[model samples]
Target: MAEKVLMKGNEAIAEAAIAAGCRHYFGYPITPQTEIAAYMAKRMPKIGGVFLQAESEVSAVNMVIGAASAGVRVMTSSSSPGISLKSEGLSYMAGCDLPALIVNVQRGGPGLGGIQPSQSDYFQATRGGGHGDYHMLVLAPNSVQEMAQLTIQGFALAEKYRMPCMLLADGTMGQMMEPVELPDSAPEMAEKPWALTGTGLSRKHNIINSLSLTPDELERWNIDRYARYAKVEADEVMYEEYLTEDADVCVVGYGIAARVARNAVNAARAKGIKAGMFRPITLWPFPKAALNKLATTCRAFISVELSMGQLIEDVELAIRCSRPVTLCNRTGGMIPSPEQVLASIEEAAAKLN
Candidate 1:
């Protein structure tokens, strides 16, 4: 039997990556997320893995690109401000189809926001933070267990899709502690036949780059990438529904806000209000089909977040105005409460009746 241990979310992410066979990690120091780099530093040496603390976030992500191109499993961790610096590198990884893991223990954003947890980076993670037509597979975990499990799985998804992946966790999730049962052993990594390891005596050398200087070639490359993105969307859309079947109002949220919304649903139900919660586990795919289906029945929807209604855009897009969707959020490091979500639900439900 695997022993369960209480762990903070950020530390869990680090251990989980190591257990997922990640032998290399390069990341700069950042608030609310430094634990990830610290853990890697403490453990990687014992495992004979490379744990490099680069001079800056930009340097760190670029190093990851170099390592990943050589066919090694690699990762990087940062908060919102640091992530912004790495955006260009993230874009390059996407363009070249390199598989790497990027963990953003989100903090208030725009610029050196704050160390406190915040969801302000929702758009950047889901909308391809870099300047290109590529999408990174995003996993949003609301619990310590999922934090570890998702960290393990993010690597596989990135390798499977041949692209970078972001594990979008808020500061609260990273700082909080909970019991988690980690994997018994490192997961088996796929063979990188396309990796640029070496061609010593191989028939041909492997090339990795996001650049296609020719316009027509770049267009073809982009079109092909979108085809793969569509496939990922079809296969990877993930979300969780809580008592939404007969509810009059559905509250949609993720991460910490989702946790609060769950409590709000329970309280609303106790008060005889038919309310439910929908958690989008994958922020990217966004689970449009399931949400659209729910919109056909629910009287209204409330999109909750720790940011000023950033997620509402996706919720509105998902429902296509089939139902009225309102936002209940807090920004600049403020946390959302269950009472606030319930109030928003009551407000939305009132509009319905």
Candidate 2:
């Protein structure tokens, strides 16, 4: 067994990306996620990797596109506002069907809100963020271990589907410290035949671009890309169900919110409230099937979030509004306490009677 080491969540993500065979990292430092760039800067050179801090988030993400075009394992990290600047690059990567890892360690909201933790970017992440008909695989990690584990998984899933992947974590998850077991070996990378490597007169030249002049041609490309997304939806939906065998009230959450919900569920359970927790690990390919199934048995649901009721919308959509869903959330970098969630759970239980 690999020995566990105590490390901050941001550092774990950096180390895990390295373990996943990422050799190129281009990012600009931002609050809550700067540790990722700092770690990469100090360690990338010693391990024959490249870590370049660009002048701006826009420049860094464009650099990611360049590296990905060469069919190399590449990554970039940023916070909420920084991610906004990279939205254009994200769309271009999706249009080109380029695979790369992007990390968003979220902080407070709409415009340079605050440096405190927030899940306000949930919609931005799961909705593809930029202009286009596309989606990126979004992974939410609650713990330092998951922060590391999901980084490796994000790289594999992105390469498999030939699209960008985002690690959506909150400021708390980025700054929190915990024990994690790093990968024992580096992962094997996939071959990219379409890469823009020189032909050496051995074959036809390769082209990597997102441009399509014809409207019908662009339509077909979007359709085909969605077909691949459907496959991912079918095969890659990941989530966790806790103490839900006969739960009457279900609490839904993800990332740091899920961590808090777990504690609330425990408290409710001790009080004989029969509460359970459902946590989505993959926000894009949401565990819709699983959540819909839970709706059949659970009478009501409470969405715990660090945003103003963002995750609740998905819960309602997943269950098709069959069961009553309520929101228990805090915005502007505020977090819901266990006692608060317990009160919501109790209220839900009472209403079911």
Best by lDDT: 2
**Candidate 2 lDDT over residue span 23-68, tens digit each:** 8999999998999999999999999999999999999999999999
Question: Per-prediction TM-score, please?
Answer: 0.98, 0.99
User: Candidate 2, 337: how far from true, in Å?
Assistant: 0.4
**Inter-residue clash pairs, candidate 2:** none
In order, what lDDT does every prediction score? 0.91, 0.94
- Tell me how far the alpha carbon of residue 152 in candidate 2 is from the true structure, in angstroms, after superposition: 0.4
Prediction RMSDs, each to the true structure: 1.1, 1.1
Given candidate 1, what's the lDDT at residue 267? 93
Q: Across residues 232-283, which tens digit of lDDT does each residue of candidate 1 receive?
A: 9999888999999998999999999999999999999998899999999999
Indicate the TM-score of model 1.
0.98
Model 2 TM-score relative to the real fold? 0.99
Candidate 2 lDDT score at position 97: 97
